[model samples]
Target: MRFTWAQRLTIAAAIAVAPMSAAHAWNESGHRIVARIAWDELTRPQQVFASELLVRHPRFAEDFAARMPPDIAARAADDPERQRWVFMHAAIWPDLLKAEGKRLSERIAALPAGAEKTELERRLADVKRYDNATWHYDNKPILIDPYALPPAAPPGAKPIGVQQALPNALRELDDRNLPAERRAVALAWVLHLLGDSHQPLHAVSLFSARHLPQGDLGGNVFFVVKPRPADPTPVRLHAVWDDMLGTDPKLEAATKRQIVAAFPRSRLKQELAEPADPPAVEAMVNLWLDESYRAADTSVYDANLRAALLAPLPAGATSALPVALDRRYLPAALPVARRRAALAGYRLADCIRRAESRSRP
Candidate 1:
């Protein structure tokens, strides 16, 4: 049976690999960088506003892994069908941004003539705040996909113009009636939307009943490696990428040193200084995501699978899918999740550097 991308994605999860709880630790690393940069650039009030926004919508910091409904996973396992093109609509982040933008435009149009100038200034400040703060969430890490979205298509078909969604969302904000802070929220969401849109599994669907019943639940339920040695519990796929990657204190520190050593402060600063314009940030995030997925498939995933296969079976293993848990598979799969998360972070930082540079006058 020719397994579709969805199947491959799920199968990677089904295998007992890592613990889910710690699978997404790497997420904090990226969010921290973005938050730090935003804090440095904005006014105290603006900083407060950005902080509140992030607090209100913490999902922006990490993939909403646990929130994924069980139904999403059951459907994939039971049917095992390829996902329809429509399922891949730019992730919910972009839609949220579009909604927020409309709200902002509404606020803008209601300004009185006497207040228009002040209002526009406030609105522009809000825009800059977002433009500055959202680089990491919205535009960092360019996605380099071999399969880019198509331009025009049917309602349920995969839309190629996904990249255009954010800019359009921003334009809508430019036309809305949102309060300044709310406008900031909208822009922040737009930043985050770009990141979510680039995550490959976000655009995929899976078989419903052949093996596992649930769909991928945006990959939250699909299990992957957890970095620790003793705890061989399986973690969901989304969580793996969301946090785990190089997040293990030992692993994260080691990886951080390597990235720093290889890229030096000068290089890191230059990379972070890349453009943060709506169009540029969006394009860059897409490019990074594409590259990360490519790496995940070849270097990361392949290595994990090999490790799982090679690890000796624990004491009594009956079936290929053993009731008594497999040791080798668990240890091996754990690293794949960690590696992918690291790559995602790496690409994210790369995109942010480019966006940051672009943001500079």
Candidate 2:
């Protein structure tokens, strides 16, 4: 069946499972896909770095440790902080878990008919390297949406872009360089920041119901909906979005499948073909930022931004801003997170592919 432009847009947006919170959390499925892609293209050292960075699941983390060089493991083990860091890194990113499943299978496939654990361990470790030299902290402001109009300040207030905090963090990274061994850890920090920056609650400000009562501390102090359905209790709004970040992938996937099944093949094809490169990740980041800006630009989202804004807001709550707030148009934001994850994974793979291919010749 053919869908109208509005229908198609709505369908695509709905695939994402919006209405969810925007707090930062690890996205495992996304992490897995990315690791799988990166593992397929990257050599040993690169795979190790990428694998460690991707956090699809707990088993994958164990697999990573199992595959690491004994010497590197000993060094990591000796340093409790380093060992803990690796484990924490795995806990945060979901893609690594996804890749672990495939990473093990690939190894098993390459072995001789009766290859033993010793040979497998040797091959895996031979490819994995513990190089701290390759990573660096980039403090440069990676602008989410350079194109969006800057947010206006209230009568006497100063104007600030929603991307404020995370960009500042990134900028700091670019200001200093790290020695090679420490580079991987540095990358992890920036990666976390980038992910955090994309969350709308983290990106925007909130305030009281009326009379400009009080400012919400980036949603930290503002009381929004409570986590429980039966209670009218309140909690910080920021936490809501953060929790939504990784709430349920099975539900997210089910929603996406339903939406895509109805999606127009032509348009879906076009979207898939439009751009899938590293720059695309940058662009999508910008797009999400722009959408946030648009939502916050006026008292509310313009018709263009209305969909994104209303999609996530509580039902029946009117926007303080001028933009229309239609309850019927709410779209789930999970799909957006999923796509972002995929793009991040693909972009990471692309980066590693270029590096690995260069080493080949």
Clashes of each: 80, 39
Worst 10 residues of 1 by lDDT: 81-90
Task: Give a tens-digit lDDT track for model 1, residues 129-167.
Answer: 333212222111211232322223247853333345544
**lDDT of each structure?**
0.38, 0.38
Worst 10-residue stretch by lDDT in candidate 2? 133-142
Tens digit per residue, CA lDDT, model 2, 1-361: 1223453344334324432222333344333333333234445555554334333322334545555556656674335334433433432432333344447558777776664855666544533432111111111111123232323435874333323433432333233343332334334434443444444444454433331123333444433333223243333444444554345645544533443344423333433344544353345445545544333333221244324333444454333222222332124444544444444344344444443344332
Estimate the TM-score for candidate 2. Answer: 0.40
Q: What local lDDT score does residue 43 receive in model 2, on the 0 to 100 scale?
A: 53
Off by over 4 Å in 1: 1-30, 37-179, 194-218, 225-228, 245-282, 303-361
lDDT of predicted model 2: 0.38
Give candidate 1's TM-score.
0.39
